[model samples]
Target chain A: MKNIFTIIKKEFSRFFKDKRMVITVLLPGLLIFAVYSLMGTVFSGMESVDENYKPKAYIVAAPQNLEETFSSILEITEKPSLEEAKKAVTEGELDIVVVFPSDFSQTIGTATPPDVKIFYNSAERNSVYGYTFVTAVLGQINTSAFTVNAASDKFDLATGRDITGNLMSTIMPMLMFALLASGCIAVAPESIAGEKERGTMATMLITPIRRVELALGKIISLTCFALLSGISSFLGVILSLPKLMGGMVGAEAAAFYSVGDYFMVLAIIISVVLVIISAFSVVSAYAKSVKEAGSLISPLMILVIVLGMATMFFAGNVPHVAIYIVPLLGSGLAMSSIMSFSVNPLGFALSIISNLVITAAFVVLLAFMFKSEKIMFKK
Target chain B: MTEILKVENLKKSFNLSRKQQKLEKTYQKVKVAVNDLTFSAYKGEIFGLLGPNGAGKTTTLRMLATLIKPDGGNAFIDGKSIINEENEVRRKIGFLTSELKLEDFFTPNYLFGFFSELYGVDKTTAAQRRQVLFSKFGIDKFAEVKFGNLSTGMKQKVSLVISIVHDPELIIFDEPTNGLDVLTAKVVTDFLEELRAEGKTIILSTHIFSLVEKLCDRVGIIINGQLIALDTLENLTKEKNLEDTFFELYEKTTGDRI
Candidate 1:
């Protein structure tokens, strides 16, 4: 027991003494702050359409009173030929072009609805807004044409914004998982394979301590470092939440994650850190050198990033129960679930329990490897 | 002198692919690394197992250290069977090999503390023992220097100190002076004499015949995974010098000119 503690203490002290480790711990926080602050500034500086409301419209056959009806809303432009108008729309010079056939009034008078061709470039970046504005203008003209009472339907803009906020909430936890995996990869391999390469492992092993105890002590220390990185990332995302929400939807969308939600996210993040550290421990043991260990564990970091993004894109529905049982993916799904405030107790419990089990199993595997003369004595 | 360490008909074999000798197929056969090797070291004696490269001396020492299990035999350390009671055997032995490396990030003092703790030495006793060992070895002056910054000789001294921190009954060193300078080598040889005076059993493996002739009470020669000769240095060198005796043993085992 004392030997194990001594090894653990020495490992941690060596970690702190390395300049690379200190930079690793601080770099992520600094990067998150810098990146989000820049994003916030860019988002706040965007010019809204409401501020400059000049509605450009193309008229084909100018009705005598058409000018009067749209006098306030429309900015009348010179009627160009069809080819010129299409070119203008393609070039984004015109919002939408309305073409009236030769029998415009006659077509409207008949029972058949008049075919008023609205030409706009759908490939244009802001074409969706152009289409919506054109539709609103047409509706106003119809309302004026027939004075029958028309009921206005109120659309809840908040629902779409709320879903987006929920998506962000799901994304934040997954990001935490990725950060933990990255941090673990950066440190765990060196803890084992690096020591072996440096010829320190044999020195530590001959002590009266059991190999399993040493393995466990390393796992515990790594878990602590991984969890610290996870929490730091969680806090980074949380601090930037208001700014992200404001830019993505609006201020009202920022209220999705409360203190309770934060706590759950934190719990999920810690579980995720454990799972990653455990996985890295196995890889580290298999590696013959620190470089080899890094290569072995690099796939894990990539997997975490991919899983986090997948969880974000597929927020509401995780595909299968089997995914929740998979090592790193399970933590990601559980974290996403917690962030969305849809806690499945069974899934969460399974993730935590499975992580612990996997960690224990890896520690045992490392102990066995440490005992192997083939591995330990390999030149 | 009482026998403190013994190896009886010890043998170790490793799987070597034989298909490469014929076709390019992948089949392996057992190749003996140490074949029926037997030797013993008594208390207060410096025993040397001398051999050229690939002579199974290391394999023999490793078996005695309980680092590896022998294929066909057992070793006893302080009356404890290495095969049956490995932990007890390990506790009673201090094993070192040239291949064993130290963590370079630690100072000698830090590493001493670590090994002392692992040896189950209490904090106060460990500190006292560390001070005494450092001073006696003349390592106290640079005890705070990191192992990486220290010379190879200093590192060897530190390795020796950590190996014997618990003061085991049997000390095993493989190629202890292989890479040391003349000065450092002399220091180590002198230290081994002091350890012999203190009644500790010392088993060393070396390729240097002169050093073995000077230090060893008894000498054993191994070649091609077999112990070819075992006797006191005087008897082995009765009619010839130690070099001629080594050449004769090598020729006898390998059927080669020396």
Candidate 2:
């Protein structure tokens, strides 16, 4: 027991002494924080743009009292012809153009209504902005029309906005899986395969300690580092969340996650990290060198990225069995469930069991490798 | 002097498959690494297993060190069977080979501490023994330097230090001075002599006949995995020098056999 502890201590000391290990462990965390923080700043700044700007609108074939109705909200441009207005919209000179057909208000007063063309260039940013402004004015006009027909009911607009915020929170699970895969790939390969390439492995083996003890020590240390990296990545996603949401909606609607949900999401992420680390440790032990290990584990990163994107795009509850058995994907589904406050206790329990079983299998494989002289001394 | 280590009809063979055999064209045959080798080392004697490169010297040492298993036969260290009680045999012997390299990241002092703990030596006793060994071997001066940054001679000395950190009853060294400078080699040879004088059993494998002639109380010559000769230096050197006697024995075994 003392011998094993001594070996573990020696191994850790050797790892901490290397500058490469330090950089490998910390650089990903730092990079994620820096990148996300910068994105957050950009997105937040864009979110702060004022909503009251009366963008210029070109009108052709003006309806009766239409000028009076829109005068308070829109900055009217020159009364151009239909063709000229279309050209203006295309040339970026007009924010939007409203064309009233020949029988505009006459048809509206009767049963037959003429079509009103709201022409805006979808390719231009300013044109989209003008179209959005006009849509808001149109919405208010429709609301007044409804009020004139019947008494208005008390309807909270904030509740509708919060629903959109809930939908966006669904992407959190995929982000967590991405974090786990990235962090594990960076640390696990180097811990075992790198030691072999650097010729430190043989020295480690000749010590009086058993192979299982060494494997456990390495796995525990690497899992801790990987989990730290996962946390940093989760932080990155969190830091960027408000900006991403605020850009799509208002600041009030963007703060979707509660303190409880954040902790639950973090727990799910840690579980995913353990699964990735255990799987990668086995891969690392199988590889003859660090380069080979890196190559072997690279596909895992791609899988995470693809799965994360898929989860983000596809919303709703996952099947119970899949939520438990599918390694990183299971944790991802659980994370999304947590963010949406739709926790399934059965799925969570099964997921923990499955991950623990897989981890134990990896540990057993590593122990077996350590005991095999052929494997340990393979050229 | 009492017998500390004994090898009885020890043999080890590894399977060698020809390219055609690997393709399922023929059956693989066993190639012997150590064949029916037998020798013994008494306490206070420096025993040398002399052989050329590719001889079974390393295989023999590995078996005795319990790092590898012999195919047929057994070895005993301090009356403990290597085949039955490996850990006990390991505890009684300190083994080193030229192929085994030290980790460059650690200082000699740190490595010493690590091995001492591994050998189950008490802290104070380990420290005291470390200090004495470091000074006696003159490795104390550069004990703090990383093994990688040290010169070849210094690294070799550190390797020796870590091997005997627990001060086992019997010490086994495989080509201990292969890569060392003359001065370092002399220091190592002198140190081995001192260990022998202190009534410690020492086993060394070397290709250098002169060193064996000077230091070894008994010598065993192995060729093609078989021990061809085993006797005291004087007995093996009947009427010729050690070098001539080695070649004469080599010719007799390998001449018509190949």
Residue A83 Cα positional deviation in candidate 2, in Å, after optimal superposition:
43
In candidate 1, stretches whose alpha carbon ends up further than 4 angstroms from where it belongs are: A39-167, A246-260, A318-323, B17-30
Q: What is the TM-score of chain B in candidate 2?
A: 0.94
Residue range B32-111, candidate 2, lDDT tens digits: 78999998999999999998876889989988887677889999999999888777887788887766677888899998
Fraction of real interface contacts that model 1 preserves: 0.52
What is every candidate's C-alpha DockQ against the true complex, given to 2 decimals?
0.43, 0.40
Which 10 consecutive positions of candidate 2 chain B have the poorest summed lDDT? B19-28
Give the total clashing residue pairs for model 1: 0
Per-prediction TM-score to the true structure, in the order listed: 0.78, 0.76
Q: Worst ten-residue run, lDDT, model 2 chain A?
A: A147-156
Encode model 1's per-residue lDDT on B137-196: one tens digit a residue: 889999999888998888888998889988888899898887899998998899899999
